[model samples]
Target: MELLQSADLYRRAADRIPGGVHSNTRARAPHPIYFERADGAFLYDADGNRYLDFVLGNGAIILGHGHPKVQAAVQAVLSQGLTTGSETRLGVEAAERLLQQVPTAEMVRFANSGTEAVMHALELARSATGRTRVAKAEGAYHGWDSAMYVSAWPDLAKAGSADAPAPVLTHQGADAEISRRTLVLPFNDVAATRRLIEEHAQELAAVVVEPVMMDIGYIEATREYIDELRALTSRYGIVFIFDELLTGFRVAPGGAQEYYGVTPDLSTFGKAIANGYPVAAVAGRREFMEQARPGGPCAWVGTFNAHAVSMAAMCATLQTFEGGGVWRTLQERMSYLEERFAQRAAERGVQVTLRGRGGNFHWYFTDADVRDYRSAATSSAERYRKFAENAAARGIWLAAGTLSHHSLTIQHEEDHLDAFVGCL
Candidate 1:
């Protein structure tokens, strides 16, 4: 597939924009493929080449690009106007729908992005517990905020021990004090996590985890591990936070909590919640969430918190999920694609393991069962990059990087899967 127009645009963009792309992830090795339009499961590039999109806006497009329901809702909201800076009926309805869907969401507050939701959640956690330190699993990305931006993808040589990982800063100028207050733990290791929690129980304000670690390719915590963490945090009076920004509303209606039968003290949700709308939320027990303004210690205020258009989009997105069989169809499609990809890899004598559940998955170019960040870090980055580039050349758009997970949507059909496998 030729991307001459995309190349020309990228060159012009580089002269003005810092990296030739708004997001660093969109800048591929050679040049990014610029999409003119997207519909269903396909992206039409500036050069007029149609490619199957497995990236799906990094797992945000659950119902797929431009779903009729979401579009109609957004259009209706647009007719009314945008960003009133006051509470709207649509916002209340959206909150009610969220409370009905998520098991842990007794109260909800909206934010503009997942990063903001996570920051608010952490602040609430600290205020509620009156503690200074926060604990997070290595290779788990809560957000790019200073408090949680440590050890997301630390170099193995400097990441300390497998059981107790060191807090390595992910970016320059990350707050040294915040990094000092953050504790890094290994995912899916029950005993190690328990020990770390106990050791830092007094100072630890919260324990944040991605139910499925998307940064490390959707590696999920074992059932026993998740259960034990829940129990331990409860016993120690630490705020247990599930960062479901990637997993929520995608794995199930109530997200990984419902799917795994483990409810957290608090949860942060985004990505697929609004099916591509720029909205995120922090939900938890009323006692904890009430701390967000009007009545409590934590200050959670955003001008665009529950923008009318996003609220309408969210309500419509939830309506689609409520219509039944949505998740079932997505699961079946994902399973079929996984099986076909594995078969093709085996036939080609390639050593790779596909990990994850429901509509999300990762292809690691290794045979090992990836359970934790340490184990997952060993996958071949160069080989995965080359594979993504080659697949893109053949009209299959995988996630740009090795650590990222590719996702399927309700828009993805058998033909897209066949085209992907044919490329393989």
Candidate 2:
């Protein structure tokens, strides 16, 4: 239970880095565990302890750590040099495979991160619609840019009515123009969303959302809500964007749009597509995607955009996902885990609910149905934090964030899962 090496490394890191960790999500209370390496579904920390990795690189390592296919693809491209600042065959294959899988995406462009993908998607929406404002779900984590950084995890005290929630900015002191332009809509409320969209129809260029709000718990948008958004956006000529950063390939082969049978003008993807490779994409219908062309209204240029190595890795991951069995397998395994957790919680007389789709999941401390951000937030944060702490003590590395959801890799076998349950 001693994180001696991890503690020492963190002490040094804190001297140089603002936080001992790179990502804000990794800024755990005492210290973040620094892992030496990961193999399959196990993470070996600097303290030399092996733990079943439920974090799954924040849902990015769908095939698991050090997947042979992805590793081989990456290795194959290393000899060809990293970035040529020109096009290559691997890049073409990656884009073609993405468009083929996502039927709604007639064309696609690549980026290095989910945040950049979301930013570019919104810019494309604005250029195509010639509008200034955009609307997003109240608690969804689209990105961290000024425009998309509002209302992700706002204090309920300041958040306005459920009918028309205010856009609460994440940063304290900053320009307020971004907040003023961003509109917040109550997630999972079709009537309220419709009213806001209609009222601001002319000025609203885009309506961005996560089909499943995985950050706050695996809270899903009702089918009726999605249907309503599509209808409203179509009527108003507003660009609809699905920010599938966490849910893209994990939720289904195509994503939430494919799973729900809904279509959006644009969608952003990252995480699972490349199986841990640093690559993200903005995909959508030709009318919208074409705006990013050479002299078009939207600009799209990047030195490492679809660098050959990452594209090669993405192509291999997509090839593995070509057969429909991966999705089915992920669903079956997660459902089994949910069943076990439910039985265990019942035996302990604990009120809880497990929610997920694809392979992502979360267990709330409350038994009531968690259909949206507010209900999910009401779950016992203290209990969840304690559970994560206990799980870490028992050699199961769950995410340290209070409301963060967890996901398993495809490589996690029955024995690994049973060990998790045994620890619980």
Candidate 3:
């Protein structure tokens, strides 16, 4: 696949834009592939290279790129005009749908991005509990906000002990006081988490966690860990926030809370909610979410909180999942891909471990059990990076850098699975 045109565009973009990309994740080692257009399960580059897109807009496009339903919804909004700066009937309808679908959603508020949703959730938690500290899993990424960004991708040297990890800030300008208020705990270590939570219970407002740790290659939380955390938070009067940005609609109709049978006090959702449209939400118990009201302690206001186009797309995406068969298909496809790839790796004498559930999985070129961030970090990322680059060269677009999660969409078929596994 020729990337000459993409390369030229990258050079031009670098002259004006930092690192030639808006998001740091888009900055490939050599150069990023500039896409001209996207269709169902495929991305067409500026150089006219047609590649099967596993990135799927970083797992945002659940129904796949340019789905007719989502496109029609967006078109309808366009024809009606992009209404913002105020609430619309469309937004109300979308919230009602979310409340109906999400198991923990009694009251809902919209945001333009997952980060903002998480921020709002944190603020509500702090307000409700009158606490100053928050705790999150060491490798779990809620968002890039200063309060939750610490220890997301901490360097091993500075990460401190596994049981009591230090909060290592990712960015330079992140507030030190916010980092100080944030406590880092190991994922899947129930005892350690309990001890930490108990130690800081008086000051801890919320304990935020991802049901499946996405930033650490989709390492799932054990049933015991999630259950204990839920019980402990309730017992201690601390808010339990589930960061479901990556797992919301992809895992189940109601998300991780439904999948795991444990509901959180508050939940932040995005990514698959709108099927690539920029929309996110904070939903939870009514009493907690009420903190965001005008007279409430926490302030929640946004100019484009529920942009009509995004609301339409979200409603359309929810409609597609009404039959409950969408998740089943995605699970079957992901399992098939996992099996085929494992077989291919065995044939080539390559050691690989596939971990995760639903439509998302990670390829770690090691047999070690990836239970936590440290174990996942120790895996052979160099080998996986090389594999991803080779796959991209051969028309499969896996996101570059780290052992990232690969996902399938409703549009993926057996042929795409065969092709992907065959590439390995």
Measured against the true structure, the TM-scores of the candidates, in listed sequence, are: 0.97, 0.97, 0.98
lDDT of 2 by residue, 1-424 (tens): 7889989999999989889878877777688788899999989989899988998888898888999989998988997776658888888999999998898889999999999999999899989988979999888887777888898888888888978998888786535797768989999888888888989999999999899899887988889999999999999999999999988977888899988899899999998999988999999999999999999878899999898888998999999898877788788888888888788878888887777877899888886678877788788988887787778777898887667888877788777767666544
lDDT winner between 1 and 3, please give it. Answer: 3
> Which residue pairs collide, candidate 3?
none
- The lDDT values for all models are 0.86, 0.87, 0.86
Superior by TM-score: candidate 1 or candidate 3: 3
Candidate 3: residue 337 lDDT (0-100): 85
lDDT of candidate 1 vs native? Answer: 0.86
Q: What digit string (tens of lDDT, one per residue) describes model 1 on residues 337-409?
A: 8888889888988888776566888878876778988888778988787787678778788876678888889
Mind giving the per-residue lDDT tens digits that candidate 3 earns over 1-424? 6679989999899999999999989988689878889999999989888999888887898888999998998898889875788778889989988988895678999998888999999999989999978999987778778989898878989999999999998888888788867989888999998999999898899999999887667788889999999999999999999999998877777889998999899999988889999999999999999998898789988888899989999999888888778888898888888888889998988887776566877777777788898888877877877787678767888877576777889799989888877665
TM-score of candidate 1 against the unseen true structure: 0.97
